[model samples]
Target: MTQHLTIVDHPLVQHKLTIMRDKTTSTAGFRRLLREISLLLAYEVTRELEMTTTTIETPMQTMEAPTLEGKKLALISILRAGNGLMDGILEMIPGARVGFVGMYRDPETLQPVQYYCKVPNELDARMTIVVDPMLATGNSSVAAIDLLKKQGARNLRFLCLLATPEGVARMLEAHPDVPIVTAALDAGLDDHGYILPGLGDAGDRMFGTK
Candidate 1:
């Protein structure tokens, strides 16, 4: 099956992305925009969530209404920058279970090394969504998915604010089962593995500490 990669080009998301991309945007503004755009993207990502009917009583009469079905969704944030997106998604789906994965690159091997991992209970039963602001080289994202798979999370999706073609290709090649939901796919990656014409270091910009 072809891995689904959705590039949400919603006007609100695009407008906020542009504002966040401006070098002069303040840290506060960046954080706010990230949250706003994340919410918009989250709405798109969860559009296909399964729903069931539930009886509800209205003033006029009782009727069945649509409600989320099965297990509650899980949101796993690939730490630091991912946390920024996580916060906004949480606002939209407050009941979603939360998980964290921390990966750092090894200078010698240029590979991801997981330093931390903690996921919610019964991951296999839930639809897990991994949130990260930027998909640069896809090393950390791949590593994070590896860890999740090891933890028994079979149904998984990755959500990001920005993605590079290289990163999308890498993720597809590495893990074809996982779908990627992103706000925008920029041109490509730079020599240093940074997304071209992309907002600079997400974590640094969100935290105001380049």
Candidate 2:
């Protein structure tokens, strides 16, 4: 991903996102749309994956077949809301290795506090994608990538459902090499770090929790 930030603009993605943003949408519905949209976003994110051709025997003839250069990819979800995006991405890419960073925003300071982190081994050799539903303050995303770099993750990308300009700029300043792929870049965030005109709390909307 050469660009710092890539926003998926497919019609299906926009349609599902519009429905997901509705206040009347139920928990089940919201979760379903998120998952469905994830599949599309996953496609866009992986579009630039390195590919190689291999010789393959077709019934009566041999031909060159295109295949992904690497067999495994590392997907690190920034929990707990990141799990929502990760689930559907997993469906599309069942062979991907999974990891999690358990962190939460401090209401007062809006900073990320890490509680747990377990990522795949040999991250430097694989393309690592960090998944999170919202890029509100960007503190958590930046912190998570910082941890991954310390753990030897060199190749990295960020996948999110929604983002704000402040968040994108922060990520660029913190980790310019890691490209960002999101469904939409919404208006600025509110006073409490919530996205404006955003679909409420992603974790809360997906899980029916406060």
Off by over 4 Å in 2: none
TM-scores for every predicted model: 0.96, 0.97
What tens-digit string does per-residue lDDT give for candidate 1 at 1-210? 134788898888889999998989999999999999999999878887889999999999999999999899999999889999999999989999999999866656557888888899899988999999999889999999989998999899999999988888899999989899998889987766678899998999999896
Best lDDT among the predictions, by candidate number:
2
RMSD of 2: 1.3
Weakest ten-residue segment in model 2 by summed lDDT: 1-10
Native-referenced Cα lDDT, model 2 = 0.93
Q: Which pairs clash in the backbone of model 2? A: none
Task: State how far residue 86 of model 2 sits from its true place (Å).
Answer: 0.8
